[model samples]
Target: MGSEKDVLVAAAVFLFALISHSEGIVGGREAAAHSRPYMASIQVPEGENMKHECGGFVIADQWVMTAVHCMPTGPNGRKVVLGVHSLSEAEETKQTFDILELHNHPDFRESNYDNDIALIKLDRPYTTSVAIRPVEFMRQGGTNPGNDAEVETAGWGSLDNLGSRPDKLQEVTVDVVISALCRRSDYFGSKFTANMICAQRVCPQPCDQLYKKQDTCDGDSGGPLLFNGTVVGITSNGGRKCGQLKKPGIYTIISHYTRWIDGILGLQPDPTPEHSD
Candidate 1:
């Protein structure tokens, strides 16, 4: 009975992570190899599993980064599995672990979905292997990503909006759309700020509705938006339906919050200036 309960707890954690990828975001960019990136496999609480989505990334051996939404309830009794490539139930690589502490952004606001970042302190440092290494951050001094850059997003969300959910990580490439285009949309509203960046299809024509599968959907939120192998944005939110045009994907612009991230992570900001020129 005790073992069965443990297995149930493990399933909840995986399910939450799967849901995080369900929420959509934008863009695709080429990644440069700089450091190791780790995905957080959160151990879900019993009933809250239905509300939360798993989120985690390695910043330190004992620390994982994620979104506030990933913890539907307070941080007690959660866990994080440090190293794994696939989160699929059928996959042989998945492992289960526990969370030590959840340090959510102090200014995190749930009302409008702003300031959604959070950090998870693991109960113990994860042992590293070839498949699982630590990921490097801008650490307050990295350059901003380009608007036209290509980025890659990986998650376990559904293959297409309103379709069957995926059990394994699904990676897709997207191009960053200029902020002006993203903000000007009637759907995004004036709330779109420098703190946010947007991405969408580079097509001159509209996509098919039934098969309009290029955009992020219900579970991709809180995932990494990588450009040039640097973390550029946090997968946040978008309009109601996925892949709808003039309603492009939106993200928490990483460059705009470097200081905040640095402050939280206790890292020094970059000394160099970023130029639009």
Candidate 2:
């Protein structure tokens, strides 16, 4: 990571903090070939009129959730589009909605990426479509995942190590690694906190070199981390490289922030109507 000033600026501009010591990831297959599908796609405002960069998703009829880094406190007008499959507006069947309110986690800090979560209220409820719908959260007192759990991830990020952004959304499957191993990884270690969860692949002892490509990079941030049909975490950060060994992907643990989110959303433990499958 860079200095606080540089990290803040890059976050404000919706650019990845491509700090030094970064390198290329393994080529060919993606690490998340069987992960769950993503539910949100938000376009954040940038320099001038109506332009945006960051992506987000609608977590409720009126609320869209995403990474806090995508939008720092600013005067920018961030708009969101639900039911969108492609970045192109014409390809989307649902109409775009204005962001009536923006709420970054009160404790969010761009410098260190702590409390990297935010929620936006849409001006209008979009018509749900196959491409878009409010993803249901695991019911209250629901099942929690164990070590090495099977999970899926989806996003509209870069497809290859050196490739440009994907035109359409993509989905993949990956496995959760032991939290202890993940915490000890270079990506977390000193910076790891109870708010973050780690996920990665567990290759067989005599694995082929192809298993090396299982990880997330930039652009995949703010996406969902689903396990057993429920979102357990939200993509936050990882190693600067695309897929570096001993450096697992870090996500904001959703359960840890449930009360904070509920306080913001003003809901009970089981916020129904918005959480139906």
Candidate 3:
């Protein structure tokens, strides 16, 4: 995961995904088939058909991670749809599972959106395939890509602020906005915190920072924010309107809850060294 080739690959993604000229996607493009095998769609039952509610990503064969707000309220529980690129297509590799259990961070609060993370235990393990696998989490001790570094986020989020959802998965490249800037009164203000991160599409040459750009909107909540080929954050929320000027997409920083996540996964903590007399 620390290889130089991985960095080059990430660099390549941003190099070709230059700033967009169109208002496309709030500004994004359709992703390639099976390009992101770890992507999952959180869907709730609507009569005979399942309705897409939010996005998630597989962290392990049987565990999926998402925003705490994405958890269903009633007993009906949401389903985890993996290995899919389009919500409407019945692809051969697509796999769906009823959630066996859900673990939301105990301190999570919808009001301030702090500690807004959750994990889903699938009824069964995901089928490993060219179209199904887990996304990489930043290993312990890994560092963030830092401010203004290009990162990629994908989802079937609304194509516009008016609630236009799409069938095909979409992806966009954005730059990490330093927290201090996002914490300004004009931005998220007191609502922003260290545990949260903000990112937005970079404007093309000569454009201002607030220039309209691509961003995740409704139905994109609980999705992943990948930096350097690993999961580093989860889509939490945005402003009253999607792609609103100055409201960069806010995310729950994954590293802040790694211990809780690892504990829930039953993983052992790193051993401490013994002292000699």
Q: Best candidate per TM-score, number?
A: 3
How does each model score on TM-score? 0.73, 0.75, 0.86
Backbone steric clashes in candidate 1, count = 29
True-structure RMSD for candidate 1: 10.1
Question: What TM-score does candidate 1 get on C-alpha atoms?
Answer: 0.73
lDDT of 3: 0.83
lDDT of 3 by residue, 1-277 (tens): 5689989998887866663333334688788889999999999989888989999999986999999988735226668899999899789988999989899888887777888889999998877999888999764466877999888889988888778888888888888888998999999888998888899875678987556677888888899999989988899998878776689899888876767788889987534421111
Per-residue error at 240 for model 3, in Å? Answer: 1.3
In candidate 1, what are the lDDT values of residues 182-262, reduced to their tens digit? 667475767566666777664445644333335655666766777777667767777777667776667665565556556
True-structure RMSD, every candidate: 10.1, 11.9, 10.5
Determine which window of 10 residues in candidate 1 has minimal summed lDDT: 26-35
Against the reference, the lDDT scores of all candidates come to 0.60, 0.64, 0.83
Q: Model 2, residue 156: displacement in angstroms?
A: 0.7
Stretches off by above 4 angstroms in model 1 are: 1-37, 46-52, 88-95, 202-211, 266-277
lDDT: which is higher, 2 or 3? 3
Query: Could you give candidate 2's per-residue lDDT for residues 1-277 as a string of tens digits?
Result: 6899998887866644331111122222322321222355666555554433555656777787788887776426657765655565465364677778778888876655778888887787777665656766544456657777877666766654674566455655667777777666454665777667777664568877544466666677888878866787777887776666677777776665666678788876444332210
